[model samples]
Target: MAAFRYFSKKLLSSTLKTDIRAPVSNNYVVCVRLLSYTPMPYDGNPDPGPIFIKKEVQTLLTTLTRVDLAKVYRKRKLGGRQLEQPVYKFMTDEQLQEALDEAKRKVDEILQIPPVVAVRKPRDKVVSRDPALQGLDSSNYIFTDISYGVPDSERIILVRDTEGTLRDADWATRDRINQMYFPVARRQVTPPKMFEDDKLDDLLKRGEYNFILDRACLQFEPNDEFYQKVCSVTYQHINENNKFEDIRSTRHFGSFAFFIAWHKMIDNLLLDLIESEHIDEANALVELYAQLHGEKFRGNSIEEYIGKFSTKKAALELALQAYKNAAKQKHALEEGIKRAHGLN
Candidate 1:
């Protein structure tokens, strides 16, 4: 029985190989099965145990006929994913060489064409003339034989060249006439000569005179000196009383202080931006407000910054509100003091 089973298995394997090699015209059915085997332990009774056997009962996973195989090969030749093979196998060597030759011909044609040249026009010649004399020559040109005394009657003078023909005034002739009549204004005071070593001591003494303060000895009533002293004392007292007021309330001093405060606020805003991980915005803020500060950061415009971090924006707004509130409180205190003293 064992010899008969081995002969049957050899016959089945030969049949499968023959079917695989057969042409598509011959229809053949292929049967496949999966089996598993296990070894049973012997009980030492001088007899072998019964063999344990198991079989997979599943149907065939796929059934590809010869026609299906041909179809898959054709599809793969046209760049389909059904089969794994070199793409160039579908094309002949002569066809591939012809395509390369055609590409080379096109490239050679492009290389043979000459490059386009740019044509530039010649620049206009700039006539050099004194800038001050340009407007005067066009407006005021005294024609020969024209008298300015005849104001009532209309005098039409025929302007002509030296050849006795009517023509526009030549620039050379006009410039000559302008030079003689409208002479360039001369400097009234000549520059002082350099001081010599011996005269330098006197010059230094004269310059030191500017530092001297003349104090009046007499304090007469209704005199300019006494009135000046009184005005100075009154201004000093006013300043002392309003010392608690916001410095931004003064004219030039206020403007300068506000500018400095604005710069400090911008710098503080930079710190907020840095803390929010907005390095680009912080750098841009420093650059845009560089003029407010002494001149440190200088680069691209603020428009280049693209960040919209709301945290930094809110921080700056809060800081500005605080500054405004502080100023308002100082002003209120000053006003209250003035009202108490009957000076408001």
Candidate 2:
């Protein structure tokens, strides 16, 4: 069955013009990513957020992403006005070059991923208690500072419970009051139904990873529990589906790669890199693995690193063989054409 599936994949690839890796059948049970090197998904844990922030690891992740400037500056849905007129500017050679440089710098900052910290625990500190104010209301009174220029992090929020205990507002109440006062452009006070477990699962099954990620980034802070949970589950789903390319070149890819690397499950990711002909990036991933684990590699090649993989050994070997076979076939075809034209 395995041999048959591989043959069928090759035949299908020959027939398809634009899409090579997309399966011949959407319902095909087999994952097409080189026989599932590292079958199980890594739980986004041991919170690599801190380790990822290290200068060397950040550089490696950025290199793996293979940034595309066009995609980097692509306008995204901030969810306010549907239409806006494009501003036109006329400038000389130096002015236009400076403007382009400035734009790239700004986009680089925007693409800098939020740290994937562990979810923040709630704080329920009692600010004050008033016996005289007790029994004044059945529900809590929520107050928010709505002054302009007040950053959300520093904004004061207070909740007065029915017992007259004034405390820091819980996350839910805080979000509600923040929305009431200075609402984010598209986020809801109450989260959308799609974020619910069942709905989120269905979306993941449908491969709506980018949508989940984009909405999660917009709806919650990077450190929020719900935000972390959503991203965690989505990353797991992408891993299970062998769909790393789905998040590649976006801001999320760095975090995604870091998540897998942190868990020491880089086989699938490494295979994906090799299959895509990203040999240098694959080596960079190995370098990231060494840094994360504090292990020293004697050699720089992927061959040296594969000896360390405990799972998916046979499958990863086959994947490497297949990549080499493909590269040879491509080179031979190019040389044959050259020889036919008497140029080689």
Candidate 3:
């Protein structure tokens, strides 16, 4: 059946071409053997024969013994076949060169154009101070909404010192900074540290907290459940206490400290969920913060990330089974080969 299919393919290829003589059906055996070295569509593999078709007959003759090819050709020709003269005989060297050169030029032309970049420039600014920027604050924080376009968004920190120089506690712009601090503090689920203006400034510089917070606001969480939860938790944590030391002494620290602690808690909580295959829920809980604020996060689509997880699991199992089989067969193969060669 395979031999019949093979001969049929060669017959079809010959018939499809014009200006080329077609092979006779009687030469099926020779044609089938020659076509074995060529890939077939039955294997769903691309035919690579066209790539080597331009090779010089002398070069081909070196790799393949002439007797082998001639035997196949002669047998087919003698089998009462209407012989198709080799196509190479009809094409002069110059004609072949022109064909090859044209193919090369087309390939070169295709490769010359630049590919389009997928990421377009964001049409919005990072921070804006305009009254129109109110609802959009849900998507982005507005520090100064000046109309002049900046190349990239920036986190704005307004600092005004009463003493002018960098003196400890002497700065009167503490109120302005505190205003920003309060909003962030309200967002933290637990007040981990004392709520003091100076501590807030120090925390911002020490932890690089604003960068993390900025992303959290813009993160795309479905139905906004996670965002609402985070906001409410933070608001309660900060407003519930009055004494700064008492709040600082509590199990949860200020916003910066609470953010870190909350992440660890969530990671621990989700481990069992992910392990037990309640991973979709685990993903939902982790996804928003993971995209925006999580430390170990890298950007990945939900499907892509899950696909990688399944693939890795399958691959590991296959590798382990292969390793065991290989180990068991290792010395047995050597012994068998030695005995087969009569050297044992």
Candidate 4:
């Protein structure tokens, strides 16, 4: 029985050995060989003939060879989807010089006119002073009367200094004295007349137009809410006027007040121009004003146009011109003010 068992064990061991040592499939063997193999380095023959190649092309080729395959693929895909093409054409040396020369000529033509001074027209009406009130002495007036009882008589009398004594009185005291002694009727405080669309034609005809220029003063900076409101109103008026063929000029134009007001407006406009870096245009406007006003515009014309130099006085004069032009053009002032305020 033992012998039979021993014989069975020996048979099982022999069978296991045979299974372990059996050959693998042809496909499996091929895959295993590939996985284990190390590729041999290229050992091709050197070039027999000299190769002509540009340095740039060779460098590019070498650079491309070192770049990762993934990166190369990405760059190729992006290149195909390029959004921008160069707009400027290549110019020859002669063509470039010619273009530059033409630009210079145009600039010269623009600045050819010398700046003229703006001369203000003389006033038609002269103010008259009353002879009776001109030489009247205020030295005899009592201290109480002048001060309106703010300072005690004893204290005032002690001080005895009367310089600007009447000027120091409060508004209430002055108003009361004027009411009692002068006996002048008080003027009623009424709101300014609001401009209406219906009344515009009549106002224009009567030369009583109150458009943007009336409100667009230098009292407020360009960024101020009031200035913006003035600009908005002016633009609206200009746009409305465009509908009519024979538009009348603004009522204030050519008037002394208009001249003064427009000059002030120009000061503001020039500031706007400078802030915008439109130095050439600003300088031209200055020259134009100088011509109109007969004022001396300081600074060399060539230097000013090229933005090489500028002066406060010249800038101010230019601004005045800008203002005059704006009033003449109506909407130009509003546009300039808006540009200065960065609203445009």
Candidate 5:
């Protein structure tokens, strides 16, 4: 068929029966399957070119990083509440006093200190009170009002300007401290509904229905792309005339049937020729793809990634394993079909 030989090699090597246990913390089991309705795109379309659409989808799914999640969380306005330190603790005693003095000086220099009273008898012609000096008590001088209270306690100091008005700076430092510790925003716990609806809404709402509606159309299609090539070889020898046909109609069936017989034979030969390369990234790809599929097909929630595969390869293996396991459980999809169709 087209060049799906690569996929068969990769698929078979990876799909051999394996029992991957479900993680203890998780409640979901993941599986993989081809998302296709037909094989038309691959029939005669050899050389699918370098730009395959499914690869683009895989890239988008798996390449999402923490930074991208951060952006999305920011847009959704869902984030952890950042704790704030006390503002009073951030300032030193010198800064507090400097601010207080600057504020007092701007009003009036005399206001910086309390004013003295000029005492005299206005009608006394002899002026018995010494004009050179008033009986001023220097010890009780109001100018030195710093020791009025405890060393760092709050005390009221009033000053009268030439205009005969008073000004007071009362507990301004405490007010500044209060403003600095103003409450931060509260965090919101995003309901599971947002992820469930948003993720599948676009694919279901926007994708063209034609890619999914016609199966027979895919049969005669060229084996030009990666997926199409796999499907072509996978379903070879089966009648392509009808839209609804099971893969068992062909000789290659069961979990290990194709892998053990046909694909393995060709894979070794290809490795001798091409020296193929594979990496751990393949597992990540499978998981991402399965996640998207579970969300799309099973109506699973993002917060509860329970119904999807954790990786692309794992999902595929799960599917193959499921098929084999179903047989071991004395159940097969064909038997289910027979019962449904009244042939059981």
Candidate 6:
């Protein structure tokens, strides 16, 4: 009664006495704009999905990632279920080894590389228009069926706008409504603030690549826009700042490597590999680079082929020579120590 009385003053007021009228003054304008949304498809890309299926590309990406199981399975906050005390068991050496092997086998499934696919279009499909429902309610209504064993993707979710237009809920609407009706364990109805552009920059500056990727993977599906934007931006930052070390051993590395390769910004990454004296990985990087550029440079040595690189050539060559010098000095030192010991 009080709420209606508050709105009634303006809603029921005479047009002659007041400048404000009900249509524009009583929040009805907001409802009018609710149904005014125009759908626009937002994907601009040449479908890169086919390239990911190649065995050689997959292997190269995996090798570049250099998975560290300890990092992958590292202790981190997992919300409710993660707080439970882990089961400790007294086991024989063989049993422990078997468990270790089993865990190793599951890493691929757990850390499958994030793909660079086209952004999906919006889903604001309308179901019907009923004039009977008009003026029945002032606010929009959401209806969801939350029966047990029904998947969220398969569930029926509907929305009726204030304009009496019945429609299938958009992705954002459906996600919120479903979460409200049937909450998931770790998923939040609202995504974290870290995903916002400014907050994301702050996190990137703080070198929170692993944290961002982990939370993104947990909170959004692989094909979601949030997931794609955060991952892509993070990868670009890592390449630009030479911060690959932050994601080196984590599950996000494979995707990071692929992103770098796809973007044709492999100079810093190649330089890093050479500086770290990871010759095998450097060679593999060259192979992947060649494949991407539609060339086969497998016949030449890494040293021979790397000189032809168009960008940051001086830095890469310098790093390679520095690594070679260090390796030579170390070999010489070992030989001198052998002579000191009077051994061949």
Report every candidate's CA lDDT: 0.31, 0.76, 0.34, 0.35, 0.29, 0.74
- Predict model 5's lDDT versus the native: 0.29
What are the RMSD figures for all models against the true structure? Answer: 51.6, 7.9, 32.4, 40.3, 34.8, 16.5
Instruction: Compare candidates 1 and 2 on TM-score and give the better one.
Output: 2
Best prediction by lDDT: 2
All candidates in order of lDDT, best leading: 2, 6, 4, 3, 1, 5
Expressed as tens digits, the lDDT of each residue in 108-197 for candidate 4 is 342221111122222222123234453356452323344554432112221112232222333333333443443333221221243333
- TM-score pick, better of 3 and 6: 6
Per-residue alpha-carbon lDDT of candidate 2 for residues 1-344, written as tens digits (9 for 90 to 100): 33444455556666465564555465244434433322222234555567868899999988987878877766666455666788899999999999989987886686677576656668788999997898788888887777789887668899888988889987777777787788898888888899887788788888989889888888887767777777877876676558987777788888888877776667777887787788889889989988988888876457777877525567777777888899899999999999999996
* Per-residue alpha-carbon lDDT of candidate 6 for residues 139-240, written as tens digits (9 for 90 to 100): 999888877899987798888998899988888887788778888777889998988877887887788888898888878766567677778777776776
Error of 2 at 184 (Å): 2.5
> In angstroms, how far off is 177's CA in candidate 3?
10
Candidate 1 lDDT, 100-168, residue by residue in tens: 677655543322211111111122223233344433333433354345653211233223323333433
Q: Which scores higher on TM-score, 3 or 5?
A: 3
When summed lDDT is taken over every stretch of 10 residues in candidate 1, the lowest stretch is 57-66
lDDT of 5 by residue, 28-146 (tens): 21211222223232232222222223465324222321112222223221245555664664557998898666754543321111111111112212212233433333231111134
lDDT of 3 by residue, 295-320 (tens): 34356433333333322334333443
Q: Which regions of candidate 5 deviate over 4 angstroms?
A: 1-230, 235-279, 291-344
Candidate 2's C-alpha runs over 4 A off are 1-47, 73-81, 85-107, 130-133, 145-150, 322-344
Provide TM-scores for the models.
Answer: 0.15, 0.73, 0.16, 0.18, 0.14, 0.73
TM-score of 3: 0.16
Relative to the unseen true structure, what is the C-alpha lDDT of residue 341 in candidate 5, on a scale of 0 to 100? Answer: 98
